[model samples]
Target: MDAPTGEQLSIRNRDAHAVVTTIGATLRAYEVDGVAYLETFGADEAAPMGSGAVLVPWPNRVAGAVWTHAGERHRLEVTEPARGNASHGLVRREPWTVTAHDADSVSLAVVVEGREGWPFSFRATITYALGDRGLTVTHGLHNLGDHPMPFGVGTHPYPRPGHADPDDCVLRLAATTHLPLDPESMVPTGGPVPITGHDFAAGTPLRDVDLDDAFGGCVPGPDGLVRHSLRGPRGGVELWADPVFGWVQVFTPHAFPGRAGRAVAIEPMTCPPDALNSGIDLLELAPACTWTAAWGLTPLA
Candidate 1:
């Protein structure tokens, strides 16, 4: 296998330590003491299944790999070939440059230039910081082009309860509605539907439950952040995001490389899948405008 690319940045505070890779600006590993809170792969291996990847401009799949803006239809490269659609965005696998670094945080930036499918240019920065709250990740984007642009942002971080089996974990979300997807394309079929199973609004166990669904209508707490948690026998971990991130994509894969059984990926999204086509919760950035979103993980002992 080929070696991983770019620099590996480590940031630590009194509470936790995190490993961030310049390639895709991904979070390779995050742990408290020696136990890992985020799912991790070998250092030499590529980001497994978009684990800890930052999805930008758009988060999920785009149907037919096409979208229209300003009366112009753009055809994106189909990254999800099996589903006949474009998966994620362009930045997930790209390299980023270090802008600044400190003892507890590192900031990296990347630019998306004009291309056949995406004709707009923009710059984005991701900062990973360690604090008492565990780890806080901030993402910022600026429109470099002279016109308005539609955009969205998200991050893929698989949370593992300190080596606990995912099958025994209890998952909970503050979301009230869930998006149902078409079996073939794996795209949203219609609108948000009522949530069911394990009472996600309350708490649910991972026992025999299989999910690859996007949920919306997240009810943020008094602290102005939406939260999701995975609790195991010993302890738990919580994922929180700013109110700007109104959607969360929950995916539980049957087996992930290097790790078996269920692995959970709780993605905080500014928009749902195919938002480029549906125009649902899509953000429009004016010329020279910048937008930012924040999300983090906290350990619950």
Candidate 2:
């Protein structure tokens, strides 16, 4: 029998590290040291880390969001009221079918129904793997229908320095450009601007700054991984990404549900807010096209 709804959580562990993945791309884990750091961010509201896990039909914020697919105009349902466009796609809250499962990993697939707003159909897979140090998440997309699919993929994880105070942590972001926002609705107003105090190129102490924005043009490691980190007094956590994640959104929610200010979200995305309306970096995948992106976390000694 299929594992019970919530009981289907995959448990992966290696030495002192462990990871948990719900059948629906919800990755939550209680580290050995008692830190409940979420490797994948969508499960519960109060305990939710990533509000929307995978971005599809497009990424980031879209306004009234009009798109042309297969010679027809498509308009997505507005997930963001203020912006009047679909925020993330339908995969976040939908039930995903379990494809692969094991001790250290699990794969889940979600079928995105194409409607007037999103007229192209696609199948998305999310894989969670645990290594000796941290977790590696892979997103795979395959066009299930004949029509071309225009979309993007992203990952959201809330990392915490187990049992450490967040205010005392230092945050290092690998971003060189930031999107300026509209004052009234907080939507993207113009193009990318040089980062100033808003910049975290040199690693900014978390306490010294406060922000919620999209950033890009970061330096990648030899492994071709773009990393952002939050360091607590004892240990730190890293959020790794790839060139596919052209933009990273750093969110420090002091009013977070579970642990208050001890949480920070390093989000990986292919585009910035409102990609559909802006028509910037939008990917129109040929039929049966597939793409992948990886991000993980490891404790720093």
Candidate 3:
């Protein structure tokens, strides 16, 4: 039988290795020096809980699965019916074609055709490259339609704490504000607020926290990059993103495939949840224009 995630493409650079799948252009696996930096699943199993999936056009949820653009109301399919919201975006399960590949990198592209809800056309490309600095992922999008298009980009990458127990790891982020969400709808209830106890700005142990929160006001370091990390006694992993990714979503679940303890997903998003309607930090691309952004993971010694 074929792999559930379609073609599994492998790339490596010396001690660093990664696997990118054609479906969703997912980052199926990444490791350096035989130490897994990501929580990986079997090639035969489908991605669970949005593992390594790319979020395009929008990330997180769209309230009521409806949004108005230029006076026309667009109703997207309610993917998260339980919450009465549209979860993620339009391209995660779609198939992508391999555009380029080499020993240390691979690129995949998917053309999102105009659909009922999203009446827009665009080509999204994702490239994964491994080097001495670990894995770097680049997302490129080109508006194929005549009119301007607004969108956001994000990714779900669950970075682990090497071989250490996840609960023993410390999590840190560069965000100073938090976006409150409704418990039932899981949509933002208000604007950002000064973060308090949930703040991970100074690094907090995973065992003491249970979070499914979104944070904004990300402050870039002197290098102009927003960084987050999970550190353990052995080693750690750092996730760094461009300043364009203004929001970060952190989720910690106790159960994950192939793991006994909690797992944390540090998602770097260009905008917050429901940006499709709120228009917060959404990027508008003119016809024939292309936009690109990047984020990466580096194993820390």
Best by lDDT: 3
lDDT of each: 0.89, 0.67, 0.92
Which stretches in model 2 have alpha-carbon errors above 4 Å?
1-8, 15-24, 30-33, 39-52, 68-72
Model 3 lDDT per residue over 143-167, tens place = 9999999999999999987887778
Candidate 3: TM-score? 0.98
TM-scores of all predicted structures? 0.97, 0.87, 0.98
Candidate 2: TM-score? Answer: 0.87
Model 3 per-residue lDDT at 144: 97
Q: Go through the candidates in order and give the clash count of each.
A: 0, 3, 0
After TM-score superposition, what is the CA distance of residue 2 in candidate 2 from its true location, in Å?
14
Tens-digit lDDT track of model 2 for 221-277? 788878888777777777777766778887777766645554677878887777666
Please give me the total number of clashing residue pairs in predicted model 1: 0
**The candidate that achieves the highest TM-score relative to the unseen native structure:** 3
Error of 3 at 183 (Å): 1.5
Off by over 4 Å in 3: none
